[model samples]
Target: MRTDVLHAMRLARIDLTLVGRNTTVLFNVLLLPLLMAWVYTEAVGAEKIDGVAGRVFVLAGLPGLLLVFAVFINLVNSFTARREELVLKRLRAGQPSGPAILGGAALGALVLYLAQVALLAVWMRRSEGVTVANVPMLVTVAVLGVALFCLLAAAFSGLTPNAELAQVTVLPVLLVVLVGAPIAFPAGTLPGPLGDVAALLPATPVVEIARTAFLGGDHLSGGGAALSTGGQWMAALPSFAILLGWLVVAGLLARWLFRWEPRHG
Candidate 1:
């Protein structure tokens, strides 16, 4: 690796270490899963919805949620905090390139998401016997989701005035995921138009990919099927295009709008 890459990695490690020590981070990483598991189990039970159990929903949905939470919500707050402290401004004075700085922050979020995935896997295995089938697709979604959302978070942070408001910025994304991701039951029951719309959402493809891996292959077809064996690659192509488009737009927006010193600066 280049010297700048190494420096960026070091900075990423330091930021991730600091985040790991935060109580709020710990709560979101650890406690929130348990609460979600308990609440989902109570609400959905063990019966099959669209040929899958409530437990499968908990198993698949939790990881995707964490991916969004870490990449979108947590990273936005981190960027805002760093900007407020002039950390971003100081870093801009260094040898590291702009991409290196952002890449380092994204690497930190990826590490956190990986840790959360491990925890979620252990819980799912012990509690619900969740074993993934389409491992490749699952991995793709997780990696791409992280990248897309990290850019989104950084771009969104450009509009945020402070770290406190950063928390509020997550609300719209969170609500969409929580209320719109088709997590309450199964995708089989969704109305035709609504299901079609949900399929196009950034997180839905990832969630569907996760569901196919953990639950089974039956949910891998039609409007809500996580992945179609016939057009699986094709289906993924659109999402990849969308994610890349968003990444470009967000990167451009951040470049133009992000205030390193602060609104006051």
Candidate 2:
């Protein structure tokens, strides 16, 4: 209803304001990835990659991991903190419906995600001289990835016992995305079944989706093309299904496990 939309919008503004004021949240949401990108680029300049187009693959995959960090790690902490402080409890008794409250809480991260996407666009256009060929695919997949991770993040929030433990609780997920996925090293270059194994991780398809969008574009000349950033529409079906499958599974788990009230107190 119109009333729910209005309430959600208002909640989004309030959450955005709070996020803006939190320096730690702001840095992780905005600067950490920027720092990583800079370091990756600098390492590339030092011939650390040992492969041509390494920087390109790095750029393409960084956004997905960044999104995972922001939503899975940072936003989970935010929600957990609010719940522990009884904010969620108060909100539960509030006038806003459940959907509005959840939507609004997520809207801040959604904004940050969009901003990060724009930043990635600028970086690609200016530094790599590359642009996304399938703009719609880029946008759709990015949003879909965020939604999946955000839902999972919320589900995991209940597992975090306290605000301080959020970092520890999210470590497994961070490690999975960091070590499991082919972000720093190209998927194609991975030895043996490593790349194939990575495809099983959630972040893999998200990164592949974005990488395909850029490489599939006409701007960049190919150099170290090992794995196909498959351009054919049909080639993407498996990745899309995998991500959607994870999202559905996570949603089911969230419905069963997510807590609206504080767990400890």
Candidate 3:
């Protein structure tokens, strides 16, 4: 492997170790998702939507929350914290290139989120009988969601003045994301134009793709009407486009807004 790659790997390991040592980060990474998932699933109850368990629909949407809480939000906090401490500056001054530094920091979150996803998959399979029907779409959307959110975090962190301020700075975007996401409710159930708008939210496509991948149907259609692999792809094409668009936008934003040092420094 190249030197930069090795450096990034070392940084990623350090990040993982830091996360383990930080009780707050560890809780957010490990328990927050499960708590949120439980609350959502409970709200859904034993009710079925379109002949599919409402809980399954809720579980299928887990990736959206995971992306936000486990990756995006935490990363914003992580970046801002590092920047304030001059950790990022020290890293940049070293041999690791810009991409390597950013990649290393992001990888730890990605690895944790993937582990949670794996646990979610196993739980869904055993408890809900929700086997992944469209693995490719699932993986594709997951990668896209992680990449886009990581960029979003990096860019957003640039606006944050300090680690303490990150909590406040992230709320507005977090609120918009949570509300826009098809989490507590289905996007399809939204009336006409509202549904169209929801479809455009960054979280929407990720959840939609995950839903189809795990349950084999669109959110509105429910899992009873499982689609074939080809059908799943076709159904998810619009979502794919949406994610790709967000990825481009996020990439641009990261380039423009990402800061190597604290804003006030």
Clashes of each: 0, 0, 0
Using TM-score, rank the candidates from best to worst. 3, 2, 1
TM-score of each: 0.86, 0.87, 0.94
Query: Candidate 1's C-alpha lDDT?
Result: 0.71
Those runs of model 2 whose alpha carbons end farther than 4 Å from true positions after fitting are 44-52, 191-193, 217-232
Tens digit of per-residue lDDT, candidate 3, span 1-265: 4987888889889989988899998888778888889888998887886457878878888888888888888899999988888989999998999999888877777788888888889989998988988777787778788989999999999898888888898788678766777876778777889878987888888887887788887553434476778888887787888889999999999999999887865
RMSD of 2: 3.5
Candidate number with the higher TM-score (1 or 3): 3
Residue-level lDDT of model 1, residues 3-72, one tens digit each, is 7688779878997888768998777755775587678778888866555676667567666677667778
TM-score between model 2 and native: 0.87
Each candidate's lDDT (Cα)?
0.71, 0.75, 0.83
Off by over 4 Å in 3: 220-224
